[model samples]
Target chain A: LAKTTQPISMDSYEGQEVNITCSHNNIATNDYITWYQQFPSQGPRFIIQGYKTKVTNEVASLFIPADRKSSTLSLPRVSLSDTAVYYCLLNAGNNRKLIWGLGTSLAVNP
Target chain B: EAGVAQSPRYKIIEKRQSVAFWCNPISGHATLYWYQQILGQGPKLLIQFQNNGVVDDSQLPKDRFSAERLKGVDSTLKIQPAKLEDSAVYLCASSPGTSGSPDTQYFGPGTRLTVL
Candidate 1:
């Protein structure tokens, strides 16, 4: 399993775009980068996932560099309801497990 | 399109007691997983099951915690002689079984257990 590091918290005003980056220096070649959003007292929901390059969905976008060592989750035109904890997951291999980290807490204020 | 379902949204119990949480995965999902989320921390995978067979349980405290998916659909996680550290949210998730498959896991509203 690859360990991931992200910010403890981030504050953004409403209507502003927020970008939360996760660093996984030890990410393996077979690993895929997945991002999930979690609100208080709720389960984590999938936001976006990408192996490389940029992948955009209706909810968010993921940017992965060529080295695959880091990835950034971009939320465009966020609202107050978008405030939540964001997690970056890395699945190393078949036998490897999903290791969770203290994710980035995004607080969108009006 | 029903999502995963977990029972007894909240539970409060004293130390040395026992508590059980139930979960029903999405229809046709062949893989199920159970996770424990402590306050201010991300979820930790306690166990994973492929159908009715156990796939991984490296993090499960087998001495005090036990889980079973008897029919390969609904699951029950039991904690006997609970301790203060057992206070956490138990989450159940399910996904299609296969490597390299584009199966995303669907999670249920977890069971919040408070042990005093």
Candidate 2:
């Protein structure tokens, strides 16, 4: 499993775009970057996933550079409901055990 | 479509007591997973099951923890002689297929266990 590091927390206001970056410098070539959102007392929900370059869904977008050492999860037009802990996982494809980091808590303010 | 379902939303038992958690996955899902989440921490994988077979359980404490996915539909995680460290939320998740499919896992509300 590839280890990931992200900021401890972030704060943003409604209608603003929030970007959280994760670093996995030793990421393997076969690794895939996936992001999940977790609310208090609820299970984590999938946001977006990507192997490289960029991937976008109805909910969020994932950006990966050529080096693939890091990735960023971009959320558009955030709202108070978007406040939650976000996790970035690496090598989710091959590793049965999806090692999760502490995650970056995003607090969307009014 | 119905999502994953878990039973006994909460449980409180004394140390050395045994407890069990149940889960029902969505129809047609082939992969099931059990995770333990400690407070303020990300969930840790306890076991992974493909159909009725075990795919991965390296993180599971076989001596005290056991899980089974019967008929590949429902699963049960049991902890015998539970310890204080066993107090945590047991989450059940299921995906459409294998991890290679990039299948998003649907999770249940989880069973919160409190061992005193």
Clashes of each: 0, 0
Quantify how close model 2 is to the true structure by its C-alpha RMSD in Å: 1.3
Q: How accurate locally is residue A63 in candidate 2, as Cα lDDT from 0 to 100?
A: 94
- TM-score of structure candidate 1: 0.97
Error of 2 at B33 (Å): 0.4
**Local accuracy of candidate 2 as per-residue lDDT tens digits, B1-116:** 99899999999999999999999999999989999999989999999898899989999999999999889889999999899999999999998876555667788999999999
What tens-digit string does per-residue lDDT give for candidate 2 at A1-110?
A: 56999999999999999999999998877778889899998988888889989999998999999999999999999999999999998755634667898999999999
Instruction: List the pairs of residues colliding in candidate 2.
Output: none
Q: What is candidate 1's lDDT per residue for B59-98, written digit by digit as tens? A: 9999999999998989999999899999999999998776
Worst ten-residue run, lDDT, model 1 chain A?
Answer: A91-100
lDDT for every model? Answer: 0.90, 0.90
TM-scores of the candidates, chain A only: 0.95, 0.95
CA deviation > 4 Å runs, candidate 2: A92-95
Alpha-carbon TM-score of each model against the true structure: 0.97, 0.96
- DockQ each candidate and list the results: 0.56, 0.64
| Cα misplacement distance, residue B90 of candidate 1 (Å) | 0.6
